[model samples]
Target: MSKKVLVVDDDPDVRSFVVTVLEENQYTPLVACDGVEGLEMIQKEKPDLVILDVLMPRGSGIRLYRHLKTDDALKAVPVIMFTGIALRSFLKSQKALEEFKGEKVPEPDIYLEKPVEPQELVDAIKKKI
Candidate 1:
């Protein structure tokens, strides 16, 4: 069966592009506009993998990622953080959040900066799933 990959991003253009790439590569693509909806879909669908973006409205990807990593049931699902945010900045915020929560979660299974080539995204997904 084709793997299901949930893509969470507020940007419509980026979401659409990712969806197309996944479809072309024979993977099923699921989408959510922001982290709020993304979390809902993640629980309901239990996708094989997730592609997430940072800095979304109404629940940032960072919050959702933290929740996933800390949840025993969902922690095994692979996540690829696809964002425009710099790696250093993202790590700093993640560290601060972990400190505040008194919990340390593992980093994403894969971290891909935005403007990722389609082949690169596919390869990452293939590796994770």
Candidate 2:
């Protein structure tokens, strides 16, 4: 069976591009506009993997990542942080958040900065799933 990959991003163009790439590569693609809807879909669909963006409305991907990593039932699912934010900036913010919460979560299974190449995305999905 084709693997199901849930893509959570607020950008329509990004979502469309990712969906097309997944479809072309023979993976099933699911989409959610923001972290709130993404969380709902994640809980319901239990996708094989998640491709997430950093900033969004309703809830941020950082919050979603925290919830996923801390949840025993969901922690095993692989996540790819696909965002426009630089990795250095993201890690710095993540460290501050962890310090504030007094908890540490593992970094994403893969981190890809946008705009990502189609082959790179497919390779990441394959590696994770």
Give per-residue lDDT, candidate 1, residue 121. Answer: 97
Cα displacement (Å) at residue 95, model 1: 1.0
Give a tens-digit lDDT track for model 1, residues 103-128.
Answer: 99997888999898999999999998
Score residue 28 of candidate 1 by CA lDDT. 95
* 72: Cα error in model 2, Å: 0.6
Cα lDDT, all candidates: 0.94, 0.95
Residue pairs that clash (backbone atoms under 3 angstroms), model 2? none
List ranges where model 1 is wrong by over 4 Å. none
Clashes of each: 0, 0
Stretch of 10 with least lDDT, candidate 1: 101-110
TM-score of each: 0.98, 0.98
Q: Write the per-residue lDDT of candidate 2 for residues 1-129, one digit (tens) a residue.
A: 999999999999999999999999988999999999999999999999999999998899999999999999999999999999999999999999999999999988899999878999999998987
